[model samples]
Target: MNNPAAPPSLLPANRRIVLSGEDALRILREIEFLLMSLNNIGRHYYPDGDDDGADAERRAQYCAETTRFIDAQQATTRLALMRRILSAQFDTTLGDDEMDDIERAVAALPLWRVPGQ
Candidate 1:
C-alpha cells in the first residue's frame, strides 16, 4: 500500500498539470468503475452460498476489510486529483455562501460513488 497521506500521481504538481473538464470527468468515471469492480470481486469470493462455518466467517471479515481498504485508496487518488483541479480555479465566481453550502452537502454524502454505477 502507498502512503495514506501522499498521492500516487506520477505527475508532480510542480509539472503544472492543469486538469481540463474532460480529464476531471474521466477521473470520476475511473473511480466509479474501480468501486464497482471491487464490490463484484468481493461477492465472487465470499458469496452467501459459501457462508456456513468459521472459515466462512473469517473470509467474510477479510472481504469487508478489503472493501474498506480499496475505498480509501480510491478516495485518496480522486481527492488528490480534485485538489489539483480546484487549485487551478475551474470556476471563480461563486459566493462564499454558495461554496459553504456546497461543502456542507458534499460532506453529508455517505459514499463518493454514485448509486448503481
Candidate 2:
C-alpha cells in the first residue's frame, strides 16, 4: 500500500487528494495529541519529587536537554502538519522558498543530545 505520509511529489500526479474540514481538524487534533505525548515523555525524564540521589547539576542538565528535545520535535511536527495541510488544501507541494524557511527554522533550533549518547 502507498504510504499516506508520502509527500505530494511522491504520489501519482493523476491522483488528487482533498482534505475536508473534518480531515483538517483531525490532523490538528493529532498534533495536539503528539504534543501531549511528548510532554509526558519529558516529565518521565525528569519528574517532580525527591532527587533520587541525582546531583542538582545533572538534574538541571537533564531538564534542559529534555525540554530542548521536546521543543525540537514539536516544532518539526508543526511544520510537517503545516505542509500536509497546505498540500491537501491547495493540491500543491511547498515551494523552495517555503521549504527554505522551514529548514532555517529547524536549523535554528538548539541541538539536543540523548542521554548517554
Candidate 3:
C-alpha cells in the first residue's frame, strides 16, 4: 500500500491542475458512492447484535475503516467547495499568495487512509 503521508508523484509542487465544475461533482459523487458501499460491506460482515467479545476485533476494525472513509469524504467535500468558490471568484491560475492560502486550507483538512491500505 502507498504511504498516505507521501505526496502524490503525479502532482508536483510546481504543477497546477484545473478541475472543472463537472469534474468536482463527479468526484463528490464517487466519494459518496464509495462511502455507501463501505457501509454496506461493514453491515454484511458485522451485523449489529449483542457485543459478545467474539466479534470485538472485527467490530473495531470496521469502526476504524468507517471513520477513515467519513473523514476522507468530509475533507473532499470541503476541498470541492473551496475549488468552486475560487473558480467562481477569480482566475483559474492563482497567484503565489492565493496558492499559499489554498495550501494552508488544504493542510487544515483531515488526512485519511483507505481501508486495507
Candidate 4:
C-alpha cells in the first residue's frame, strides 16, 4: 500500500507548536529592548577602550550574559505570552537574517565586558 500525501502545512503543523506572527514579534521586541538597555548601560558603565583587544573582550562578556538570559527565559509561558504581545506591536515581518542579527548582537556584547572575571 502507498502512503497518502499530506497537506502543505501538515509537516510543520504536526511537528512544532504554532505561534502567531504577533507572538514571534513580541519575543523579538523583548530581545531588542533588552539589547538596547544593555547598550545604553554599557555606554555609561563600560568605558570606551583605546585598544581593540579590550573592546573585544567587553563585547564578548555582554553577549555571553545575554545568551544566558535568553536560555533561562525560554522555559517560561510568560515569554510566549510576551511574544504574542510583540506580534501586534511590530509592523514588519521578521526574517531569519533579523533573528540572526539578534544572535550576533548577543555574541558581540562580550566585546565590552571583562571575561571570566
Best lDDT among the predictions, by candidate number = 2
Candidate 3 collision pairs: none
Most accurate candidate by TM-score: 1
Q: What is the C-alpha local distance difference test score of each model?
A: 0.57, 0.60, 0.58, 0.51
- Give the alpha carbon lDDT tens digit for every residue of 42-98 in model 3: 775567743465367787777777778668667567556656654454333444454
Q: Report how far residue 73 has shifted in candidate 2, in Å.
A: 12
Off by over 4 Å in 1: 1-25, 48-61, 64-75, 82-101, 107-117
lDDT score for candidate 1 against the true structure:
0.57
Query: Residue 103 deviation, candidate 1, in Å?
Result: 2.3
TM-score of each: 0.39, 0.34, 0.36, 0.31
Give the per-residue lDDT digits (tens) of candidate 2, residues 1-117.
Answer: 423332333224425556688877877777777677766655665576345866888678768876786686676676677676755444334456555323433444446789778
The list of candidate 4 runs beyond 4 A from truth reads: 1-17, 49-117
| Model 2: worst 10 consecutive residues (lDDT sum) | 2-11
Per-residue lDDT over 40-115 for candidate 4, one digit per residue giving the tens place of the 0 to 100 score: 5455436673325456767687667666655665534555666556343333433345543223334434244577
Candidate 1: count the clashes: 0
RMSD of each: 12.4, 11.6, 11.0, 14.4
**Better model by lDDT: candidate 2 vs candidate 4:** 2
Ranking by TM-score: 1, 3, 2, 4
RMSD of 1: 12.4
Compared with the true structure, what per-residue lDDT tens digits does model 1 show for residues 67-93?
686687676676577666655643323
Clashing pairs in 1: none
